[model samples]
Target: MRHHFSEQLDLVFDELAELCITVQIAVRQATEALLAGDGAAAERVISGDLDVDERRDRIEVRCFRILSLQQPVAGDLRTVVAALRMGSEVERSGDLAVHVAKVARLRMPRTAVPDELIPVVTRMSEIAVDMMGRTASIVAERDIAGLVELRALDDEMDDLRADLLQKIVGPGWTHGVEPAVDLALLSRYYERIGDHAVSVAKRVDYVITGERP
Candidate 1:
């Protein structure tokens, strides 16, 4: 019985690692699609979200099984709880990626994003992706300091969002109505992504410190 339980634990860890990798790839694809203005690539990311959804379901089942069968205690119990929470966070991240892809598709062909907004929006995407990557590592290693750093990144993204909005409303922004609205909406989406990454970091803090952020 002990040996069988050990084997199951190993399997649980493997599945969690694989789920994290899928999340990172999804985020990267969405970022690249936006930067390249590739509608087809953006579509692919939007469609591929089912993969993350399925992975979340599988991870939930695995966590429940480990809890029911192995009867995890102490640190092992905390690990299972953390896995459950992480699964939710990753699913939310996947949804955010889908949003990014959707924005990319909407802005293509006509070049909805203005020249002034492009650089700021692009930089926002890059920073959010980096934060997500670091948060994933924090989850894997349960690094408290890394999680703190992830929270710090939120301020930068928020500043970028503010700056982009100011540019859109400024006298120089003559991109017309449609493009202006699209740029505003895209900035909001990027800021929301940063928020979600911060949420993930908070979860990591909970997992490591056993306290809410």
Candidate 2:
């Protein structure tokens, strides 16, 4: 029975790793669609969010089953609880990616990001994607050390968002208010995605150390 329960826990971890990968891909593709003004790609991302939701649901169910039946204690209990919380974080990241795609779709044929601001937005997306990648590795490897680097990347994301916001509201701004609003929202979406990745990393730390970061 102990061996069976251990196998079950391993399966849960494997599923969580795959879910993180899915979310990472979503973030990358959503950014590509936004920059290229590809309505088809944007639509694909919007539609794919349902898969993320379903995956999170399955993870939650498995964790709850382990909690109720196996009644995991100590480190095992922490792992199960952390998995539950991490699933929600990853799901929210996926939704943020979908939000980015929706903005891209809304401005189809013409890129939502202005030409001058494209570099900043692109960098922000790069950082967001990188954070998600790191998050997936942390989940799979249970490397608590990676949390430091992940948090640093998130700080960079925050700084980029602040810079973008300044550009939108600065004296030299030429883009109309509507575009400004969209850009602001897009920056927020990417930043929030990074934030979710950080949350997942902290949860992984909790799983390994039994203490929340």
Candidate 3:
């Protein structure tokens, strides 16, 4: 019975890892589409989000099955709970990517986004993706220090968010309201993605330390 239970747990973790991969790909594609103003790429990201959504549901159901049948205890219990929380974060990450793609679609033809902010946005996406990858590794390793380091990404994202906002609100923002608003909202969504990545790290920290960070 214990062996069977362990096998099921491994399957659950595998599914969760796949969900993270889907999210990471979606986010990268969305950022690339935004930077290039590629409407077709944006549409692809939007459509691909449904796959992530379905995978999230599968993860959640598998987690519940483990709890209901396996009745995991102690450390195993932590893993099950972490799986549930991580599933939600993965779903939210996909949603953020979709949101970015939607903004890309909306701002087509005119490309309201300021050229100066492209690098900043790109850097923010890179950081968020890295942090998420780190969080997933931390969960697998149960390393407290590694999990704590992921929190620092949040501060970097905050700084980038502020810088982007300042640029949009500064003199160069005289371009027009539509572009400014799109840029502002897109920056915000990217920042939120960073937050969600941090949230995942914190959830992993909780599973390891049994205390929320």
Candidate 4:
């Protein structure tokens, strides 16, 4: 019975890992579509998000099964609870990627980001993708120090968000309101993705230390 319970817990972990992979692909495709203004790529990402949602549901169900059947205690109990919360974060991060793709689709045939702000937007995407990759690794390792690092990394994205916002409203702005609104929403999508990654890491920290960071 003990061995079987252990197997069940491991299966739950596997589901969470799969969720991370789907989210990574979603962000990469979405960012690419956003920069290139490729409607097809954006559509692919939007479709991929459905798979991410399905994976999250599987993780939640697996966690619940383990809780009710295996009756995990102590650290194992913490692990199952954290998996539930992390699944939500992973799903939300995937949604943010979908939101980015939607913005790209909305302005199809024309880049949603202005030429002047392309560099900033590109940097934001890069950072967001890197953060998602780190989030996947942290999900497996559950490192407390890594949690601290994740928090600091999000601050950098926040700073970038502020910088991007300034460009849209500042005196030198030449792009009209529509493009400005698109850019603002684009920056926010990237920032929100970063925030979700950090939230997952915090969830992991709580499972490991029994204290949320």
| Candidate number of the best lDDT | 2
Residue 201 CA displacement from its true place in model 3, Å: 1.4
For model 2, the superposed segments whose C-alpha errors exceed 4 Å read none
Candidate 1 stretches greater than 4 Å from native: 1-18, 73-78
lDDT of 4: 0.84
Looking at candidate 4, the ten consecutive residues that score lowest on lDDT are 140-149
Model 1 C-alpha lDDT versus the unseen true structure:
0.74
Who wins the TM-score comparison? 2
- List residue ranges in candidate 3 displaced over 4 A: none
Error of 1 at 80 (Å): 2.3
The true-versus-predicted C-alpha distance at residue 65 of model 3, in Å, is 1.0
lDDT of 1 by residue, 1-213 (tens): 668766765665456556666766776777667767877778888988998899889989988988898897876677678778778877887888888788777777645566666678778877777776776676656676776667677888888888878877889878787877877877777677678767766766766677755
Could you tell which candidate, 1 or 3, scores higher by lDDT?
Answer: 3
The lowest-lDDT stretch of 10 consecutive residues in candidate 2 is 204-213
- How close to the true structure is residue 92 of candidate 1, measured as C-alpha lDDT? 80
How many clashes in each structure? 0, 0, 0, 0
Residue 144 shift from truth in candidate 4, angstroms: 3.7
TM-score for each of the candidates = 0.85, 0.96, 0.90, 0.94
| C-alpha root-mean-square deviation, candidate 1 | 2.6
Q: By descending lDDT, how would the candidates be arranged?
A: 2, 4, 3, 1
